[model samples]
Target: MTLEQLQTLNSIVLHGSLKSAAEALHKTQPALSMAIKKLEAEYGFEILDRTGYRLGLTAPGKAFYQKAQELLLNAEQLHSLGQHLASGNEALVRLAYDAVCPHNLIFNVLKKCQYEYPQTELHVFGESRFGALELLQKAEIDLAISPWWPTFHGVGDFQALKIGTFEILLVAAPQLFNGQAVTNIDQLKSEVNLVSEESELRFDSENLMLIKGACKWKTRDMQTLKQMLLSGLGWGYIPRHLAEQELKEGRLVPLTPQGLDFSIQGELCLVRREESTLGPVASMIWQSFVPPL
Candidate 1:
């Protein structure tokens, strides 16, 4: 009938007795009984089985309680949403992050945001290479976390904070080279090279560290590229974090060609467009990474 009445029933079911429910709900036992009685009288059915020593729901009451529980959850969310709107929090915030960014770091920030802004919906996207930057450049997302390269300065007018660093190691299963260390790039000339490509090919010209003459296989994300490398299909660069265990287990081995750098470290930055103004929730997330002064 009312949320309070449904809450009373839920409390009784949870606590297993009217006396305990009364103590929990701050109502007298007699009043709790009258509430259940009123509900049964209106519905023409017993809502609780009084014959048992401990209180239990009747067969029909079980079904009714299930629906009531759903209603209570929705009501709680609606109340939170009302408070969120009253406080002028944005309804939604979108974030685009590079696949190479450490997931735990991003999730930790998001966990804090969720607790502080329960009603603000967060939409997250995992992108490859310059994918997140491209989305931010187009004004499609409120925030982005991606590996920052000097070439990115030419992408757009943007501001960034150096949140962390990411290392990409040139790796492949040892079987690719018959368990021998590759001594020259010529050894890979005939082999298929796994490469993770950007979603929109907007920064294809900036593809550094790629084996120039190798037969190339393009993947859309790092996981797929890692899988291909693990399968001995080709050698490619992958985030060091993603392949740490594999490297330890000798499933993947780092490659060192005669003159090529086998590993590269770049600044992982949280970026936003210079001209775009962020909403309250988005601004909160952006400020979360600011160093304490």
Candidate 2:
């Protein structure tokens, strides 16, 4: 009927006797017995079989005790969550990572945060070009992992830590070129360029390593763009790591446009708004990416 009574019954079951349960709970044997008696009377069932040398649960009591144990576990978790909130920990933290950034870098820190603050909920989103930054600027996310671009410098007052580097390579399915080496932009003009469209519409015109004057097809994310390239639907730039196996297997081949670098490397950064305040869990995640002093 009550948590205290339920706890008393649990102690008796664990210790196998009222006297032992009383000693474990720092209470008198009669007091422990009174708690159980009240519980059984309220529920109209005998909770324990005292005729045995050691106390055992009655058939009905087994089901009742099982339910009580589940309630006790939930209560403990609720108490812990209340304490976590009281300590200035946020109940939820939002994180957005650019599709171009490797998940391993961000997950390394998130895994630690999850272990330390099990009560805080993590909302993770994978965004296309500039998507993470847009979310951060809109105050929709607490943190973002994205490739750094000069365009970002004028976008917001952001604090960025260079976490790693990402490379985008121009590639196409070998079948698109029919085993012929592509040496000029003119050759690509006849084929569709599979471009991953910018996440933010304002930046839709921005193109990275796009071949000029080529017929274009657009996708919302790089993964689809890579799939399109793999199917010989078009040629486009994609994260090298995303297609490493395909490139090596000769399913996709790298392209070198004349007078232009087909491969581009950029800094992958952990970004947060300079003026926003982060709660305990978010701060812990941010610090996890910092190098040792």
Candidate 3:
């Protein structure tokens, strides 16, 4: 019935568990459970179905959560607008980015916004794209800056926005390539190590495009993979942003071996709660700063 109760219900649905929703809210499990219980009483419906360790939303729960998302967004927009108008200051904006995205474009854009909208406050968080979705569903983030996972289509909470596209590069420390740019799959296997990014997460497909090369390591963490490549440990396919500095500095070498081409396709994406209203300050950034995507 209340915003907080609706939020609790939505968070459970988003995160699929009380423990995670509690963690996102920085509340204890017991507190979250009680909040949900309170909502169940007020609504006279069962919102969650326990599945061993997972929580599934009932039909009504799913529909209710969608409305809650809109309501929360609207409430935040109203609050942000009033606060900004009263003080004539920039309003607080919280956002999230995909951790796999090393471009740091969001930082640059925010910096530009700082100069343009001096009264606006921007707070940012870094999370994997999947984690970012959780933040989006909880209405914890004002905007999401990351790559689009098409599977995300039809998620009712977001108004998805396309930004721009970037490239992924096959790279490694110079030593791995022995100072020669790789051109063929056989050469890549013979000359260096291959680090495959476990991309099964966003794709949801068992079949992956494994670059034909010598396998050195496999990691799900982009940071760990970057560090490993930086240490001159092995070669891997890395996001262009992460390898930009290294490539510029000649610390990392680009290898165009066979099957090396990889990209996220199309453009970067943004998702915000469709129902939320934005203050003038937040609206300016959202409308003006997307940069022709």
The model with the greatest TM-score is 2
**Higher-TM-score candidate of 1 and 2:** 2
Please identify model 2 stretches exceeding 4 Å from their true place: 201-208
Better of 2 and 3 by lDDT: 2
lDDT of 3 by residue, 1-293 (tens): 78888778778888988899999988999998999888878889987777557998778877877788899998887876686668655467787877655555566777777877655668888664355666776788777776675666655556777776756677778887678767777766664454443332444322243544455565556778788888878776777777778889988877766665644444567777889976666666577545563
Q: Give the TM-score of each candidate.
A: 0.82, 0.92, 0.53
Across 199-249, the per-residue lDDT of candidate 1 in tens digits comes to 553565435667777778887877888899999999988999999999999
Model 3 residue runs over 4 Å out of place are: 1-91, 99-104, 112-121, 128-134, 149-151, 155-157, 180-224, 260-265, 290-293
lDDT for each residue of candidate 2 in 1-293, tens digit (9 for 90 to 100): 88899899999999999999999999999999998999888989899999999999999999999999999999999999999999999999999998878768788788898899999999999887778888998889999988897677677899998888999888899899898999988889899988877666364464655667888888877788888899999888888888989999999999987887898889999899999998999899888888888
Flag the better candidate by TM-score, 2 or 3: 2
* Model 1 residue 164 lDDT score: 91
Least well predicted 10-residue stretch by lDDT in candidate 1:
198-207
